[model samples]
Target: MNKLTKSVLALAATTLSFGVFADVEREFSETYNFSSNGTVRVENINGNIKLEGWDRDQIQLEYTASADDKDDLERIEVEIDASSSHFSVDVEFKKKSSWFGGWNGSSGEVEFRLKVPHEVVLKMIDSVNGNVAISDVYGDIKAETVNGKVKIENAGSDVSVDTVNGDVKIVMQQFKGDQRIKSESVNGDIEVYLPENEGFRLDAETLNGDLSNDFGIEVEEGKYVGADMEGRYKSGNARLLFDTVNGDIEVRKD
Candidate 1:
């Protein structure tokens, strides 16, 4: 073939490749409608998930997926289940990308950013690497990650979190609306800062870490090995439960 002819064919191939890449593999948006209450479940493989509470009645979800090959990116899927009082947002990636695409890094990674009403329950889980962040939410919050930090603030309800190797931090203004916090890490630490004169029960224990409490409890057995700490404060109402294996557990008044 002539030089000009060969160049024209190459240009056509490049354009086609780009066109394929630009095409929408899979894209859709869903909104859940409910009246009484709502719950959201989110799971991520190797990305960050952030949730924020809003005033609207609808639950909104958005995602961004990445893959090693263009074709693999098209196979990402999101499932939405809208119930009477609960909803779930699930992300699924193609399993056999290696056999079909023959790419080296066809694994999928998606990051989720969600905004729901303040009265909705939030449950999130991540496999490889993800960080959980919730702000201005009053409902129940439960999140777990393998290798990412967990941070929550301005919450008015109960909270539960578990991580493998990441620090967990919770900041609350007035924890009087039935608080139950259980956070643990084999390598990281747990820190909680709450208002002084809070009224609630405190059950804290640690096997390999030091336990510190500002409730004026005398030290015993080199740790606060107590079943419950109640009537020590007179303001805030909470039910705090903290435990860690290889990290420090701290509970202090603000």
Candidate 2:
């Protein structure tokens, strides 16, 4: 082939290769109509998930598909189920990428963010390898992460958060009725912030770390040789339990 023809073929090959190996990034946003007492449930494999409460009577969600290879990004599905009294948004894979598309170290990740009505009755967020955060939410919050942090802030209801390999932090803006908080972590710290005037009893325990607080509650050594603290504040109507295996437990007055 002539030199000009050789150059043209090389250019075409390069373009084709680029197209085959390009990274993929895409965003999806959706809004679904729903009445009060909505419930959102999420399960994320490897990305952050955030939840925020809003005043509107709808569930709004946005998610991003990111992968080092274009085809790897196509395996994720944002599943949504909206009913008059219940709603759910889930991150699911069309097929498990571990078997089909995980060859040659292709990286894939997805992040989900949602906003729902403040009167939603129940909310559940779960992530395997990424952080989970919720803010300004009402009702009951149940959040968990296996390898990342769980942070719930400015919440106005009961909360239960658990993490195996990361920290857990909860900041309660106020107490609604008889609020209950139960948080646990296996390998990281657990911190809870409570309203100053709220009456509650704390049952904080740690197996390998210190149990601490700024509320001046005395730390009582467990009968089995661990750190356990139990005390009441004022009326002690509310209840809290912070448990950790290899990290500290701290209770702070907000």
Regions of candidate 1 where Cα sits further than 4 Å from its true position: 1-32, 97-105, 123-128, 218-231, 235-237
Considering summed lDDT, which 10 consecutive residues are worst modelled in model 1? 1-10
lDDT (tens digit, per residue) of candidate 1 on 1-254:
11111111111222212334453322234455553356677776677888888888876766655555566665555555666566666666655535557544345666777778888777654545878888777778888888988888778688888888888888877774657766767767788887764576666656566677787754344434433222345544477776666677777777
lDDT of 2 by residue, 1-254 (tens): 11111111112222212235576666666677767576767778889998889999888877776766546555545555666667666665544435556634336677888888887765678999999989988878899899999999887778889899999988887777778889989999998887787788888888889888877789988777688899987785678888899999988888
In order of listing, the candidates' clash counts read: 4, 0
Model 2, CA-based lDDT: 0.76
lDDT (0 to 1) per candidate: 0.65, 0.76
Question: How do all models score by TM-score?
Answer: 0.74, 0.84
